[model samples]
Target chain A: MSFLGGVDTSNGVVLDPECSLIGESVRGRILCFPFGIGSTVGSYAMYQLKLNKVAPRAIINRSAEAIVATGAIMSEIPMVDNVDTSLIKSGDRVVVDAANGTVEIRDVTERHVVTSILRNRGRVLILKRSDKVGSYRGSWAGVSGFVEKDEGDEEAARREIVEETRFTNARLSRRVPARGFRHNDSVWTVHPFLFDVSSRDVSIDWEHEAYAWILPGELKDYTTVPGLGAVMNDLLSRTSP
Target chain B: MHLTKDEEHVLAGEEGAARQKAMELLVSLGDIYGAERLIPVKSAQVSGASFKTIGDAGIQWLEDMSEGTRASVPSMVNPLGLDMRRWRSMGVSPDFHGKQARIVAAYRSMGLLPVYSCTPYLAGYRPRRGQHLAWAESSATVFANSYIGARTNREGGPSALASAIIGKSPEYGLHLDENRLPKVEVNLPSVPEGLVPLAGYTAGKVAGNRIPLISGQAFAEDEHKSFGAAMAATGAVSMYVSKGTVGHVRSRGIDRSMIEERVTISSRDLRRCAEELSGDDEWDLVAIGCPHSSTRELAHMARKLKNRRPRRNCDVWFCTSRMVHSRCPQHIATLRRFGKVLCDTCMVVAPIEEMYARTATNSGKAMVYLPTLGRQTASFRTTDQLLEAISR
Candidate 1:
C-alpha cells in the first residue's frame, strides 16, 4: 500500500480505493493480514497511526516482510507472523507474543489427525469420503482418521491405514512430521505416512465410498482435501531417488 | 539466531531501552531470514529521511529514538523533502520545513552525518571493496554492492538505523560470499547514448531477484550510477555483476556454470521500452537527477546549456548533492539560469504532488516513482530531449 495515498494516518482508515479494507479502520484492534505491500514509506505511516493513538494494538501475518516488520518495530506495536491467518475470524480475540514469535486465538482448539498414503506400483491411493464421515464429506483424501487421546502419531497412522483400507500387508516406507491446517475453530495437525503395499486391492469401509490409485502429479485434477497434494508430494519426493 | 554473550545481554535489556529495542529489531530480522549471527558493519546509509515521505509520525519516532541511542558507526541519510538552508525559497511551506528540521535535529543528536544526498558514496562516505554496510537507499545499496564491490543487503530504514546504532547487521543475503554469485546472464549489444538507464531498467525486469552478470559492455562511473539506480528501482535485486574491464585488465569472476537463465537485450528492445514509457509533452515541471547529479553530470549539463537560453515556460529543477553543488559553482550558476539548482532534495522524496500534476524527467528511476510518489503524470525523455525542451 502506498501509505501516503492509501492510508489516512489521522483516522487510521485505509484510503486506497483498491484496498479490500478501504472503508475499515485499523484502530485499537489486533489486525490480521497476509502481509504488507507497497513502498517503504508505509513504515512511517504506521508510526503516524501510533502517534495519533489509532494504531492496531497487535498485528498478525501469515509471513512478515520487511516493510510491515520495520513499521511494527518502529511503532512498538506487537507483531507475530507465520500464523495461519484463515483460522482467525474478524472478531476473534488474539494474543500476540512478538518475542516468541507466536500467536494464539483464544477460543480455537487444535485437533491432530493422521493422513497415510498407501502406495502400490508407483501409484498412491486416494480415498473418497462418504457422507457418513464427520468432516470433509464427499471429498477425496488419503487414509485419514483422528488420533486417539493416548496413541502416538505413528501408531495412529498405522491404525488408520488398517482400519480404513483393510490392508494387512502394508509396509511403512517413510513418515513425515505433522503439518497444520485451519478448518474453522480447530487446527488440523496432519501426520502423513507413506506405506508400500504388496497388493493394489483394498476393501473399503463405510467411511469411504470408493478409492483410486493415482500418480502424484494427477492429484491436482481432483478436488481433494486441503494440503493433500503437499502431503503426497513431500512423501513421494523424499522416497524417490 | 545465535547471539554472542554481549548480544544476548543487549537482547535481555541489560543495555539501555534504546539499544535493547535496536537489538530486538536486528534479532527478529535475523530470525526471520535464518541468520546464524550478526557481523560488524563499516558504515550505514539510511533512507526514509524526507518529512514528505515519513510525515509527522516519523518525526515523533525519531525524536523519541534520539533521547538515548546514538549511531555507533558513521551513517549518512537519504535526501530530505526540502533543502535545509534554502527551503523557503524552494517553495516549501513553513510547516514541512519545521517538521524536516526536527527530523534533521533528531538524526544530528544520534550522530548521523548531515549529508542528505542519495549519493552517499560521492559525499565522502565511500565504502571500500568487500566492506559490509547496512544501506537503505536502493540506488546507493546497488552501487555499493555492484560498483564499489562492497557488501550489504538492501535494508529498510528502521533496520539500517538499527545497524547504525549497533554497528552490526545480521549476516545474510548480500553479506555472504556464497550469495553474491550471479544467477542470470544478460548479454547487451552496446548500450546507445542516453539509453543506459533504460537498458538497466530492462535488465532489472529480466533479472528479477537474481543477480545478473552483464556482458558485452563496459560502463563509465556516471553511466554505472544511472544504470544501477534504475535497475534497483525496477527490480528487487541489490546488485549486478558486469563482465570485462577492471583497472589495468579484464577482471575474472563470471561463472558460466552458475547462470540459470540467459537473456539478451538489443537496442530495439530499449527503443521499445522508451516508446512505452514516453508520455505526453505538456509538463508543469521538468526535474532531473533521480539519484542526485554527480559533479561530472553537473559540468556536462552546464556545458550543454551554456549556449542556450531558458524558455521559462515551466518550472525546472536541477537536483544534486550539496557536495557536488559546492564543487561546481560555475556549473551551478549556469544551470540555475535554466532551473532551481536544488540541493539535499529530489523529485521522488519532495512533495511535488502538492505543486505539480504533470512532470518530465530524464531518469528511469523517476519514471517509476513520479506517478506514485510525486503524483504526477510522468513523461520519460532523454537528457538532450529534456534540455532542449527546457532551453531555446
Candidate 2:
C-alpha cells in the first residue's frame, strides 16, 4: 500500500479505490500488502500518520520498496517484508518480530507433510487420493503423508513412499528445502523429495484409488493438490546436475 | 548488500539514532536494488520540501531528524511552496507561511543549504563531471546526467535526505557503468524555434523508460535544461543522450549492438502536443520558469520585455533561484515591471491552485504538472510567447 494520496493520514483509512481494504482503518493494526506503488512523498505521508497518531503498529509486505522502507524507518514503524502476505487475512492476529525478521500468526498451526515423487524411466508417478483420506480427498498428489514426531524429513519421505507405493528400492535423487502454503487456519509446510526407482510396478494402498505414470510435462493435465505443480518443477529442474 | 565495518557501526546505532536511521535507509535501498555496497556521493539535492507537497508530516519528520543529525555532504533543497522571504506578497496565508517556516528551520538546523530551487545545477551547487549525486528532483537528476555528465538515479525525497545525512548512495542504477548506455535512438525532425520544449515532450513520450540517443538538432545549454526537464517529467528515464551530450555518453563506452530499438519524434508530433496543451489564452496567471530560470534565461526574458510596457492583462510569475535572482538585478528589475520575479520557488511548487485556476507557463515540464498538481487549466506557450503575453 502507498501512503501519499493512497491513504488518509488523519484516520489511517486506505483511500486508494483499487485497494482491497479500502475505507478500512489501519490504525494500531498490523497492515499487510504487496508493496508500495506511488509517490516518494508517500514516505512523508506515512510520517504524517505517525505524527497524527494514526499509524499502523507494524507493516508486513510481500516485498518492500524504497518508499515504504524509508517511511517505515523514518516513522519508527516496525516493518517486515519478504513474507507471504497471501497467508495473512483480515482479523487474523499476527505478531511481527522486526529485528528477528519473522512473523507469527497467533492462532494458526503449521503442519509438516512429506511428499516424495517416485520417478521410473522418464515418467513421474501421481496418485489420486481416495475419498476415505482425511484431507485433500479425490485430489491428485504425490506419495505424501504426515511426518511423525520422531522422524526426520527424509525418513518421513521414505516411510510415506514405502507405505503408499510399496517401493523399497528407490534411490534418493534430489531434495530441496521445504516450501509452505497457507490454507484456512493451517499452514502446510511440504517437504519434497525425488526418488528414482528401477521398476514402475507398485501395489496400490487404500489411500489412493487410481494411479498414473506419466511424463513430467503431462502432469498438468490432471488436477493436483495445491503447489504440486511447483514442487514438480522445482525437483525436476536439476535432475541431471 | 555488504556494509563496511564503519557503515555497520552507523547502522548498529553507534553513531546515534538519526545516523543509524539514515544508514538503515541506505542499506534497505541497496538490498532492494541488489547493489554490492554504498558509494560516497559528492552532493545531494533533496526534493519534497514544500509544505503544499509534504504538509505537516514532512515538517515533523525533518524536525525529528534535525534533533541530532546534520548533513554530511553539501546538500541543497527543492523549492518550498512559497518564497521564504516574500510569501506574503504572493498572497500566501499566514498558516501556510508558518508551516513553511518550520520546514525551512528544520532544513536549516540540519545544515542543508536553502538553495530552494530544482535547478541546483544552476544555483551554485553544480556537480563536476563524473561526480556522483543523490538528487531527488526529476528535472535536476535529468539535467545532471544528460548535461554535466554526472551520475545519479532519480532518488526519492527521503532517500535523497538519507544520502545527505550519510554522504553515500547505493551503487546501482546510473552509478554503474553498464546502466548508462542508451537503449533507444530518437531522431528529431526540424523543430521550430519555440517548440524545443515540446520537441522534448514528444521525444520523452516515445522514449518511455529507455534512455534516448537524440539526434538531429543542436540545443543550447538552456535548451538542454528545458528539454531534459520535460523528458524526465514525461518519461521514466532521468538521463538522455542528445547531440551536445553525446560526448559524455561516448566516454562511458557506447554499445551499438544494444541500440536495436529506435523511435522518431517528428515536428508534427511536437506541434500536435503543443496544440493539445495549449488551452485558452485567457489565463489567471502566466508563469515563466518551472525548473527555476538561470541567469541567461532571465537576461533573455528581460531583454525581450525591456521596451514593452506591461499590459496588466494577467498575474505574472517569473521564477528563478535566489542566487540567480541576486546575480541579475538589472534583469530582475526589468522583469519586475512585468511581474513578480520570485526566488526559491516556481509556479509548479507553489500553492497556485489556491490563487489561480487557469494558468499559463512556458515550461514543458509544467505542462505535465500544472493541470494535475496545481489544479489549473494550463496553457502551454514558449518563452517568447509568454513574455509577449504578459507585456504589451
For residue B299, what is the lDDT in candidate 1? Answer: 89
* Residue-level lDDT for A36 in candidate 2: 93
What level of docking quality does candidate 1 show? medium
Candidate 1 structure quality by residue, lDDT tens digits, B190-211: 7777988998888889999988
TM-score: which candidate is best? 1
TM-score of chain B of 2: 0.98
Q: What is the TM-score of chain A alone in each candidate?
A: 0.89, 0.90
- Name the 10 consecutive residues with the lowest summed lDDT in model 2 chain A: A232-241
Candidate 2 residue lDDT tens string, B249-352 = 46654555568688777778778888898998799999988888989999998899999999898989989899988898999999999989898888888899
Model 1 misplaced regions, further than 4 Å: A1-8, A13-25, A215-223, A238-241, B244-251
Q: After superposition, how far is residue B154 of candidate 1 from its true place, in Å?
A: 1.5
Q: Return the TM-score for candidate 1, rounded to 2 decimals.
A: 0.93
DockQ of each: 0.71, 0.70
Alpha-carbon interface RMSD for all candidates, in angstroms: 1.1, 0.8
Measured by lDDT, the strongest candidate is: 2
